[model samples]
Target: MDKIEFLTEKAAQIRRDLLKMIVNAGTGHTAGSLSNTDIMTVLFYEVMDIKVDDPDWDDRDRFILSKGHSVESYYTILADKGYFDKEELNTFCQYKSRLIGHPNNKVPGVEMNTGALGHGLAIAAGMAKAAKMSKKNYKVYTLMGDGELAEGSVWEAALAASHFKLDNLVGIIDRNNLQITDNTEKVMGLEPLAEKWKSFGWEIIEVDGHNYQELINAFTKSSEIKGRPTLILANTIKGKGVSFMENKAEWHHGLPSEEELAQALEELSSKGEVI
Candidate 1:
């Protein structure tokens, strides 16, 4: 298959895998995870330069899941990429399992422990700055939830990234509009979000988060930008691919029942051409 087709099918399967993993674990950030699956897929499978067998190779590009609660998709991608045994996903969130509710550094491919929100940007910026200092060409990518933008630290990090001219740093916002309790705007407004980032000296690129082609192009474009960090404002649908759960805030951290799981699988499978 071609690149776009390959990415689409890969993302579909990832969604399925994360769903099963979450249901088996009996807990997860469902909506956000689903929402960001496509973005994660593009980065891991195509955009980023990574080594599955040597996850910590010095020159490998870095990925930081700042919105760590939505780690189902992230973990699924890592397992699929051979960073760990895929079977380990079945133990997610279990007592003593390395795969807990959020991104954990103990995991083979995880760059840093995150989930506190607003801290990922700073950490990623530091990595980018370090790369520049060491004269390494590797890039640093960070994914953040739109809701997380409310934290003042995110802006502070944005300012730092710009001031240092960390062109190697790429920040992506999962602009799904919903958080755990309500709409992102209701919880905290982020309108003109692109302008805010621009004012902080970031080059903003907005795209359909679920569209493979747009995502690929945006990531590619980020690499070509110079003297400033890039921010990809990815507009996405929370609980995407599952009809009943789409855009519903309740599913932000909901565990699917067996029947719901079955229905979701059927829906995903119904897209015969994709998965």
Candidate 2:
């Protein structure tokens, strides 16, 4: 595959992985994982400095899925990247399975176990601070759901990152507009969201979450942000790739039926071009 085609194919595979895992589990978070599919694909395949062959590469880039419901995508992408075996995904959400609904620190390549909202950014901040203390060059990147911003702790962490001048921390907000219940704006507005981050002393970038080029651009620019943390407001659909599920809140934790699964596979196999 060409470089661009390679990334696209891998992202499609992650989408398929998500669909298969969720439909098989009979219950899992599909929409949020699907929403950030391309973002994960780009991070694992291109953007991040990770060594799958060496899972504990000390200087590797650190990623925290603060929106832990989206662990489905993280597990799939990590497994696909060989951070761990693909077979482990088959045991997801099973009784005593390590692959729970949220990210667990026990899992390889998983930096922390997180399900509760508002926890990821603080953890990322701490890690970045640690790296700074050790004078390690690693960067910490974290993603939070737009709806997850309602948590007060997130702002607290945001304030600390700026106060500490932790430029190594880069945060991303998945602005999918919808959460499990309803639209984010209707539930709790994040209008002037960018400005809010700016006031907190963060350098902000807005981009289309589904665009691999945009993702790379945003991350590349992250290294240049100085004096504090950075945030990327990634505009995304709730369910990004599949035709039926896109922007549908029902799919937040909803499983795709057997037929719907088949349709989703077909749609993703089309690679966002056409049937």
Candidate 3:
């Protein structure tokens, strides 16, 4: 298989793993996790400069999932990368398991505990600034949910990143539109989203979140940019791989029933073929 086909199959596998994790655990943020799988796959497998065996290496690139509820997807990628044993995934969300409902620093590849929506950008900005202070070349990437944009803290961090000229910081907003309660616009309008980020002094790039080429190009371009942080508005479907759940807000935190899981697995497996 070619590189693109490989990434696509990898993404499909990640989605399959995500469903299994959520089903086994009996709960998880489904829509967001599935929607963000493609982006996370590209980052972990192709973009980020990470060492699985040496996860805490000083110069390694940092990734913070601001939308921490989507961590099932993140955990799947980490395990696939050998950051931890794949068997560990079976213990996800079980009693006393390190893989809880959100990202925690205790996890090998997790940088911080996040699930409070808007705080990730701030934490990522701090890490970027620390890299600059220590003269490190590592970049800091953070992914936020579009609904999380309603929080005042995200904007505050955006302003700080620009003011400090942290070009090494990249903020990606998963513009899946759907949130836990409903569509983001209905919950809190964020239209003119690109313009809003631009106004905050961020360099904006919009792309189809599921497309490997677009995502890789956007992330590569972020590094070439100078003086300001880049905010990538990744337009995506909420429950991307499953037909029934796509764009439906009801799947935000819903668990798939046994039949639904079987159907979902079939759909994903069929699409794993090389293009």
Candidate 1 clashing pairs, residues 3+ apart or interchain = none
Q: What does candidate 3's lDDT look like per residue over 1-275, in tens digits? A: 78789999999999998899899989999989999999998998899998888999999999999999999999998888888899999999999999999997898999999999899999999999999999999999999999999999999999999999999999999999988889789989998999999999999999999999999999999999999999999999999999999999999998999999999999999979522
lDDT of 1 by residue, 23-73 (tens): 898888999999999999999999999888898899999999999999999
Model 2 spans with C-alpha error above 4 angstroms? 272-275
TM-score of every model versus the real structure: 0.98, 0.97, 0.98
List the lowest-lDDT window of 10 residues for candidate 3. 266-275
List candidate 1 segments past 4 Å from native. Answer: 272-275
At residue 92, what lDDT does model 1 achieve? 97
List lDDT for all candidates, in order: 0.94, 0.90, 0.93
96-193: candidate 2 lDDT, tens digit per residue? 99899999878889989898999999999999999999999999999999999999999999999999999999999999999999999999998989
User: Between the candidate structures 2 and 3, which one is better when assessed by lDDT?
Assistant: 3
What RMSD, rounded to one decimal, does every model reach?
1.1, 2.0, 1.3
